[model samples]
Each structure stands twice: as C-alpha cells, then as structure tokens.
Target: MKKAYISLLLVLVLFSCTKTNKKVDITIPKLTNNPSWDVVCTNRKPLLSFYISRGGIGKRTYIVNLDTEPEFNSPNFIEYKNIEELDKFIVQKRVEKPLVDKIRYYFRAKAIDSEGNESKWGYTRFSLDTDYNKNFMNLTRAKVQNVRVSTGENPKNLIDYDDPGQVSFWQAAPPGPIKPWAIFDLGKPTIISRIWMLANINRDNGWLVDFVWEKSLDGKNFEEIIDAKILNNDTFRNVIDITPVSARYLRLKINHFRGVAPHLNCVIFYTPGKPKVPTPPRGRYVLLVGDQMNGGTFTQLAPYIETLDLDLKTLTVPHYEISLDMLNSILII
Candidate 1:
C-alpha cells in the first residue's frame, strides 16, 4: 500500500511539469521603422507602408487604421485587416474623405500574431504638397484674356482667387440662357494634365454644379476633354483629369442649378513639366512707349538706364499689365 501511494505521487509531479512546458507566453512585436508614405495630387490619394522588427509568430498579420486626426481611438477610423490586404491597397488607392489641397492625414498600424496577440500601435502622418501658385497655368503664369460675361463685382477678382483675406469671386449676372463661360490663355502652348476648380461656397451652392472643360491648340478650335458632372457630397474642390494635351487656350463652361449663374472662387491648371522660360530674341528690337503716369517714363528709360545691348528685346512696364496676346507674341518679355 505504501509503495503504490509513492508511485501515484510521482505520477502527479510529472504531469504538472509537462503542462507547464506546453504553455508559451507571447511577446509584443517591436516597430522596426517608420511608415513609408506618399501623396499624389493628380491621383487624389495617398499611399502608406508599414513594417515591424519581427512578427510575434511565423504566420502573422497586421491591422492598419487611418484618421484625419492624430488620435486613433475614433470609432469611425478606416481599418484594413491582414498584411496581404494592406500591401494590395496601393493598387486601389482611394481616400475615404476628399483630400483638401494641403491637408494633413494621420495613419497608424498594429501587428497581430497567429495566436491573436496584438502589438501596440505605430504612427505616421503625411500631407499633400499641392501649391496652385506653382502651376503652369496659374495667374502668375497665365491670364484670363476674354470671357462671355463681364466681371460682376471686382474686375481683377476673376483671377485673384489666391487671396485668403478677401471674399473675391467671379460671377455673371442676368440675360444668359446657357451657362456662363470663361476663356484663359496660357501665354504659350503648354502640356496640361489636370485642372482643379474651387467653387464659391457662400454663393449658389458651389458644391452642386457641372462643368465642361475644353482645350484648344488655337483659340478658335476647342476640343472637349472632360464632360462628366461632378457631384460633391462634402468636398469643396473638384479635380478633372484629362489626357496630356498641348494647349495654349482652355475654356470652362459652368452649369448650375436653376437659372442662377455659377460662382467660382478659383481655377488652376497643372502640367507635368516645369514652366517654360522665354528665350531671348536674337535681333534688333524696338521699345514701344506707353503712358508714363504709371511709371511710363521709367519704362522708356529702363533699357537705356541699364545700358542693355541693342540686340536684346527688353520691355519693362511698371504696372506689368501686358495683354496675354501681346505677351504670347513677344516670348522674350
């Protein structure tokens, strides 16, 4: 009886050791590097990448979350499960929210082991670097040569949409059955890939409007490149993609709800390459003199004052109000 009791005690001890060895505790994963992120304004989407020092288990996955705010605790956060799905996300790059021109976005990632153990969150942020002023067809580079209707309130406000302090907008009033339209000359032929339009939010329900964008190599003959109606639920900006067309002239015809004319805050054009710098004319030139009230005497005396070479074509206007057609003809200006 004593020998049998001792043998039972030994068996219980061995079983307890076996159970302890089978149970393994999991360790949290460590972040190896910061996330890889990029934003493309033309695509209107941002790309994100995640990495860890090592997944807790051999077969592991990840969870990615995106938010406008830095905090990741919101219930409305956009989530993606599994590493394979997260990696495949680049192919179908789409932003849940319409991206503002220069707004910042926040992203975070967490790793999950095969045993369902999750690591702490890793964070990253990115913003779109879209500067409309740098665009090839901006007001600094191009001009609104002619329009079907005259300016409604401020004459210069048609193209001066970049000013943040003023409530400057372009509007056409009365006697128009068709939509109001405007024509812009880019000063010279440029390769344009996209067009961005920001509507006047205060007037005429800017978010609800249809636009027809047409491009022309010569001002007379125009070809419609985009005709789709953009319906914005919450966004203020509308981006239109077009085939890379070498055009010097572009026209935008606005169709608004009811008979109310469309009000535009800003319009911008984007090209792939850098802005074209005018080459110096290689011959004798003449300096056409204009009114000296607005620095006209200074304009006439500029070439002589600077002792410019006779071969160089130098025209200096104090007001810099040269017409787009004249600017295009004289490339050296």
Candidate 2:
C-alpha cells in the first residue's frame, strides 16, 4: 500500500511540472510603419498596419496602446481593442486621438487569438510638428549664388529664374565625348528637401532621362543624392522629393537624353520653411487657382471661364508663388 501511494504521488508531481512548463503559442503582431529609428514628423496622422504569422481562419482581436513615454506609465495613455474579421489588419488611416505637437509618442500593439492566447507587444514611436508640414521656399532662386557646368553655354540660365515660362535654356552642346554636368552654389550650407525641374521647351523629347544629383558642403567634395532615370512625363514639371540634406553646392550630371542636346529650362531646389508670397500681378485680368493635378475641376469650370471671358492661370504651390491678376476675382481658399 505504501509503495502504491508513493507511485501515485510521483505521477501527480510529474504531471504538474509538465503542465507548468508548457508554453502558450501566440502570434505576435508586427508594426509596419513608424519604425523605432524613424520619427514621424507631421501633424497628419500616419497609417498604421500590422502583420500576423499563422493567421488562422477564425477572427482575432487587436490591442493598440499609445503613450507619451516609453514606459507607457502615463494615466492619459490610450488603448484600442478591435475585433477584426481577418487575422491581420493593414493601413488603418484613423486614430482615436490627436497627438499634441512637439511631443514624442510611443506606440505598441498586441494580438489575441480566438483560443484566448495573447501575443507579445510590438513597439514604435512618432512625433508631430508644423515645421514639417509648412510650405518650403525654393532655395535655387533665393540661395543659389553661382552656377557652373562642364559643357554648356550660359549655365546661369538654369538658375536665372524659377519660372517655367522662361525662353532661355542652357543646352549641352553635342559632338563632345564628355557627358554634360551642371553645378549650383547655394551660397551657404542649407537643408535641401526637394528638387524641381522644368522640361525643355526647345524639343518635345528633350526631357531629362538619366542623371545624378549630387551635393557638396565645401564645393570640392561631393556625393550623389538622387539618380533619376525612369520617367512618366504627364506634366511640364518633374519634382523629386528627397531626404533633407544640407549642402552648399548641388550638381546635376546628365548621363543621357532623347534630344540632340541636353537642354535645361529651369532647375529649382526647395527647403523646409515658410514659402514666400507670390509677386502680385499688375494690370492683367486673370483668375488664378492653385495646382489641380487631374484637371477635372478645370474641365468643369471651362464653361464658366468662357462665359466670364476670364483668363485662367494655374500656379503650382511653392513652385509658383501665389499672385492673382484682379478682375475683382474671388480667390478660392
């Protein structure tokens, strides 16, 4: 009887140990955007998406939390519990709350299965600032003090004006074995956010093909910021938004193009700051509107323009400063 009792006790102890050692198999959620190193710098809410491994056929629950601190100890921290039909949710556009400006907020999310198994939390952080959203000025017009090119006539024409309406063009004279290149001096070390190019009006096929945009601080040493190649020329403007870089000199090296000579109409660079108010128009009666990408609105207003005998001028923001020629026109906000 004593031996049998001891055997039963041993069996119970082994079962208890095994049960305690068993691990819960839960699928942890993955945060797609707003990685740890990247600080989202806009007031506009960013899309949040998540992925789950071994997504079962059944429904799942997602728990998202946000806090101002990394430890997530704030009493004002927000939590969202959503039951999703799919095992994964992606690119969610809305957020429950608005983040305060200048505050760095931490984000975390976890997943729970139908079986009540919970997953570990994934984490990220983001911040908000109006400085990131403000319309920046064209530095090529305001900052570029000098222009130089390896093989071109009147390189100053590239920086002479930011207007696409200009007739002057700096052309890469052909028959020379050397590739065409142009350098722009920004006067000082300035942070460049975007590069805008106007298609050459001289030739229909004179669009830029393969080129590299490089930057230099001292004007002696340089590094490439953009390598532009593929193009879909739907408009007269080609704008390239790059990661903000600080440099005193910007160089454009033209590798190849469609026309006999590489013709450059205008090249403008923009940096983050308040954009200058456009020069007001004088003595002309034209209705001005901001850039309309698809021209659907313009098509609808064609009848109105014809009836009013009004000249229509469409100006792209920051690229073309806002100025209206008044026929006592009402500027649409």
Candidate 3:
C-alpha cells in the first residue's frame, strides 16, 4: 500500500510537469512592406499590398482599417481572409464613398493567427494629388472687359458682378417697355463650355425672373444658350452647362422683375484654349425683323443666325434693310 501510494504521487507530478512544458505562440507578425509617399487619384481605386514576416504560422486572416483618423483596434476595422478579399474590400469602399481630391487616407493592417492571437497593427498612408484638376487647368479664364446695361440704378455697379465675391451686387432698375438687360464683352473669341452665375433677389422681397443667356460671335448677332427662370428660393450659385460654343460677347437679359431689381453677384465663363482674337463691339446689326420683338422671335432665329455667323460686326446701324441681291453679295450681314 505504501509503494502504490508513492507511484500515484509520481504520476500526478509527471502529468503536472508535462502540462507546464507546453508552448504558447505569442509572436507578433512583422510588416514587410510599408508604403510611403504614394500618390493616388481621387477618381481611382488604389490597391494596397502588404506582406507578413511569418506566413507559415497558421495566419488565418488579416484585419484592415482605413479611415481619416487612426483607430486601428476599433470595431469598424474591416476583416479579410486573404489578399484577394482585401482587394474586394477596397473596391466596396470606393463604391460607397469615393475618395476626394487633396485628401489623405490612412491604412492599418493586422494579422490574426489560427489561435486567435492578433499581431500588432502595421500602418501606411497615401495622398490624392491635385492632378485631378488637369481638365480645369487646360481651360482659359474668360475675362469681362466691358459691361453694358440697358437700364440700371448704377451702370458702374455692373463691374462688381464680374468677380465671384458675394460682398457686393449689381442691381438693375425696374424694367420699362424695354427689358432690363446686361451685356458683357469677353474681350476675345473663346470656345466656352460652361457659365456660372451667382445671384439672388433682394432680401425680404420674393420675386422671380426669367434669366436668358445669349452668346454672340459678333457683338451684334446674339444666339441664346440658356433660358432659365430663377426664383428667390433658388440656389445662389447657378451653373449652366452648354455645348461648346465660340463666342466673344454674352448677354444676360432679365424678363421684367416681379417686385424689385434682381441682384447679381458674379458671372463666370469657362473657355478652352488660349485667347488670340479680341472681340469688340463695332455697332449693332439687324439679322432679322418680325412684326414685334419678343423672346419667341429670337429663339426662332437662332438656327439661321448660327449659320451666317461672323467675327466682326458688319452693320453700322441698329436696323438695316437689305434686298435679296444685296444680302447675297454681303459675306456677313
């Protein structure tokens, strides 16, 4: 009985020693590739590749986090079983929230082993360059050299509307028999794609006005590009996208104001290529005359006027009557 009791004690001691000798894997995986100074486009999806120091250690998955702030261990961290899964995650993020220009993206990655032990977070960063503005940079800025108004409280106030600053505004007087219109000379012939206007009706007064944008290769013969009605509740910045048109002069005609004069803050014209030819007003011309002058008359005449386009004002008078024989002889009328 004493020998049996001694043998049982030895067996217990050997079992305790064997359990204590077992090894636990607490090794943290090291990052092999840490990217720096990587530039990516705002419109494109960037692929991030990383390497782990020990791939054979039963690494089951990776935990990836991308955010403007560095919170690696947060609940929002994305998990991936492999590199292909990580790529899919990037594609999904891009579809949800597109990366914006001039912004930095932070990326953190960690490896999780089969034993559920997570490695230390590895970090990298990438930035979006301003190269996305290449399309805008190629276009030229159209300058407003001259401003003419049919009727206004202060004609000189029209100059303030050329800049985009909203501090000052140009106010036109109440429309009379002749509609209040503001004509602008862009100083040169340009191929324009877009026009932007920042305007608002006078405060405390709700009013609406039909704003017409007319473009002219010559100062005299104008063609309408945009005919839009603007209300007091409309946005301050109004953008008009039009097919590219070559023009030297642009006109903003206001169809009779409702309550008071409409306030205009800025007018911007975007054109492609460099300015080579200067467009100046020589005189007005009579392209076509109907029984009465109205908006419908101009819209109907746009197709004909576009065909017989001219760079210089050929007419010396506001109204001119030419016979069929004389019209055929004139190159531009």
TM-scores, in order shown? 0.38, 0.41, 0.38
Name the top lDDT candidate.
2
Model 1 lDDT tens row, 40-115:
3333354444444254545557777776677856554577777642342221223555454565566666667777
What would the per-residue lDDT of candidate 3 be over residues 1-333, giving only the tens digit for each residue? 999999999999999999776554433333324333333445534545565434323634666666655564544334444432234222112213444557666676666666666666766656666575443233445667888888665544545532233446567676567877778888888778777665552342313346677889779998877533344433344667677888889887776444566667666676765322223244643344332211123234545554575532322211112234334444343
Q: List pairs with backbone clashes in candidate 1.
A: 292-296
RMSD of each: 16.3, 13.7, 21.2
Question: Backbone clash tally for model 1?
Answer: 1
- Rank all candidate structures by their TM-score, best first, as comma-separated numbers: 2, 1, 3
Show the colliding residue pairs in model 2.
none
Output the number of the TM-score-best candidate.
2
Report the lDDT tens digits of candidate 2 across residue range 1-333: 999999999999999999876766666666655433235567545555556534533556778887888899897587778735242444243565666667777888886777666778887666666566364233333367999988758788876662333567788777377888888998999988888787654345666677778899998898988543334442335667888888999988777677687777778787875444444444343444434321123344544554674554332332244324221233422
Q: Which ten residues in a row have the lowest lDDT in candidate 3?
A: 313-322
- For candidate 2, the 10 contiguous residues with the lowest summed lDDT are 324-333
Candidate 1 Cα outliers beyond 4 Å, as residue runs: 1-155, 161-166, 201-204, 227-234, 275-333
